[model samples]
Target: MNILVLCTGNSARSILLESILNRFGEGRVTAWSAGSKPAGQVHPQSLRLLQAKGFDTSAARSKSWDEFEGPQAPVMDAVITVCGSAASEPCPIWPGAPVRAHWGVEDPAAADEADWDVAFETAYAQLKRRADAFLALDFETLDADKLRDRMNLIGQD
Candidate 1:
């Protein structure tokens, strides 16, 4: 399955969840992250935490959602929004009619620099639990409606 994670900035929660899904999906899924209004760069603390967790940060860039719209874009099976603003804003109409879910997390990037470590860690842990719940489902077998319902439930975890 192909999953797209969205956020207002694409620098923190969305980036983290994209990495988590790809790492934990174990070849079952491909994930990408984008923002409605990108910061144009990944957050430094996000990169630090991911690198500490042994993730390859070479291809991790904050990008616009426009990159995934229209022809030639990868057809997403799911589009997840990881912040309240991104979840509530209008999203691009993806080619594949991906199931949409809101997995809102407090933006660690909003925290003071000194508090970034704990803030990002808290967001990461919450998102990891939600991602794990989604990964635990037999999603490939379920129909889109069933998959969406389950995904929404996972978002609340």
Candidate 2:
């Protein structure tokens, strides 16, 4: 399965979730992340946390959602919004009719520099919890509607 995580900035929460999903999904799922309005670079604290957790940080970047709207783009099975703004805004039409869900999380990037680590840690924990729940689902047996419903419940985690 292919999943896309989105946020307004794409610097922290979305990036964190993307890394979490890719690492935890093993070979079963491929994950990508982008923003409605990118910050142009991944947040420094986000990079540090991901690296500290032994995740590959090289591919982490802040990018626009437009990159996934092209003909050759990977067709996402699901698209999850991790912030309120991206969830509320009218999103671009992704190539495939990806099931959409909102996993609203507080923006760690919006926190003060001195509090960055704590904020990032909190966001990481929440995202990891939700992603873990998602990975536990029986995708092979679940239909799209059932998967969507389960995804919504996972978002609430």
Give the candidate number with the greatest lDDT. Answer: 1
Candidate 1: which stretches are off by over 4 Å?
85-96
List the candidate 2 regions with Cα displacement exceeding 4 Å: 85-96
Candidate 1 Cα deviation (angstroms), residue 157 = 1.7
Per-residue accuracy of model 1 over 76-147 as CA lDDT, tens digit each: 989998885433644433345559887888889988999999999999999999989999999999999999
Q: Rate the local accuracy (lDDT) of all candidates.
A: 0.88, 0.85
Residue range 1-157, candidate 2, lDDT tens digits? 9999887778998899999999999878899999888999999999999999999899788999989887798888888888844236444334355477778888888789999989999999999999999998887578888888888898886
Per-residue lDDT of 16 in model 2: 94
| lDDT of candidate model 1 versus the reference | 0.88
Q: What is the lDDT of residue 128 in candidate 2?
A: 97
Root-mean-square deviation (CA) per prediction:
2.3, 2.4
